[model samples]
Target: MTAKVAGIPMILCALGVFVGGTIWTIVYSFTNSKLLPKTQWVGFEQYERLWGENRWLTSIENLAIYGACSLILSFVIGFVLAALMDQKIRFENTFRTVMLYPFALSFIVTGLVWQWILNPEFGVQSIVRALGWTGFTFDPLYNADIVIYGILIAGLWQGTGFIMVLMLAGLRGIDQEIWKASRVDGIPMWKTYLFIVIPMMRPVFITTLVIIASGIVRVFDLVVAQTSGGPGIASEVPAKYVYDKMFLSQNLGQGFAASTMMLITVAIVIIPWAYLEFGGKKRG
Candidate 1:
């Protein structure tokens, strides 16, 4: 009884913090609140301005590119790595440990490390030039066009290991009899994986998709530590935009509106797929 009573307050406090905060933000989004929230309603003025800004639009575009490339590349690379590991090679545990070590570091650390490594003066480009490739130029952070791709590479390096581990676990869960039967039927390994194994791992894939999507949506610390939306907001992301508007720009209303749009964007991406994947089963 005592434990139950204690847990009730904890649950209520959590709900108050999360649910209450969300409601507060949403309510203030319609107002002209600046620095501090006020009850002066403005009825979509904040949203209109948010959508009108070029930086916000750029942020949205960057997120789309990053999210799409990250989703496809991470899954492909992770599955490929997982398949290789499933081959019963020597020193499998050592290889897995090495591969997954990057995921142990936080995004801030990963970003800082990659930032230094990708720096033109003292990093890869410099090393290559020192080795008689003076004509070579590989500076993504300085170039506005390809800056997001630089962030993508760093994100993939830090994230794919976790996805690979997940894929490997899914692979290991398959019955050995399935492999034997496929082999006996003279089915090629690739075909077997595509036609049989992958379909069986749908749940694992969906779980991984959700995790990666959430990470993509909330990616801010890495961008802050790495590029800081450099080269004139080229690598700007929605989360960073929200932070800047809320704190840096001192426009709480606009920030709230941007956050709401982000929530809407997530819902738009996730809802239909989720319905097709899980919701339709109830009707069936």
Candidate 2:
């Protein structure tokens, strides 16, 4: 009873912090607050302004492109890596450690390194040219239509390792009896993994997806460090937009409004998944 009583206050305190921050953001979203908060309420004018702004619209579009590509690429690559690592292959620990090392590195460093490596004049492009491929040109980072994909590649390099770790954990936790049973039944290894293992790992996959989705929604550092919203705002994400408005552009109200929109967008995307995970009818 004492422990429960003591824990209640800490829980309440944490809830208070969360609720308080959310309310503060919501209130700021409704005002014409600049660098500093102002009490003057401007209703939903900030939201209206965002909708009418070209840059913000472009940022939203870019975010969608980056998010979709990152999510798909990360999941696919991570699953493949995890599956490959699960095989009783040589140097399993080395491969696992190599794959997961990227996740340990700071995103800032990842972005910087990738930026250098992808630079048209000095990186892969130059190296290819030096190899007598004079006509080769790898300049996606400079092209508005393709720059977002470049960012996605760098993001995947780091993000996939995270998903790989999660999937590996799920794979390790699977029952060895299932593998033996499949072998006795003459089921192919790939078929067993696809039809049996993958399905059983759904809960872990969903959890990893949610985590990656949150990262996608809140992605900021990679964009800033690598593209800085691009050669023409082609890589701008909602978080970057919010930062620009809050600091560089000095439009706190608009920044908070963008943040609110992001919060709503994330909620919309995640709520269905949450219900499916927690509220759906259970299967035996």
Clash totals for all models, in order? Answer: 0, 0
Judged by TM-score, which candidate is best? 1
lDDT digits (tens) for residues 1-284 of candidate 1: 99999899889998999889888889999999998999999999999998899999999999999999999999999999999999999999999999999999999999999999999999899999999989999999889999999999899999999999999999999999999999999999999999999999988998888889988998997899889998889999999999999999999999999999888777876886698688878888
271: Cα error in model 2, Å: 3.0
Off by over 4 Å in 2: 1-13, 280-284
Residue 99 displacement in candidate 1 (angstroms): 1.2
TM-score, candidate number 2:
0.92
**For each candidate, C-alpha RMSD in Å?**
1.9, 2.1
Flag clash pairs in model 2: none
| CA lDDT for candidate 1 | 0.94
Candidate 1 Cα misplacement greater than 4 A, ranges: 1-7, 269-284
lDDT of each: 0.94, 0.88
What range of 10 consecutive residues in model 2 has the weakest lDDT sum?
A: 275-284
- Per-residue error at 174 for model 1, in Å? 1.0
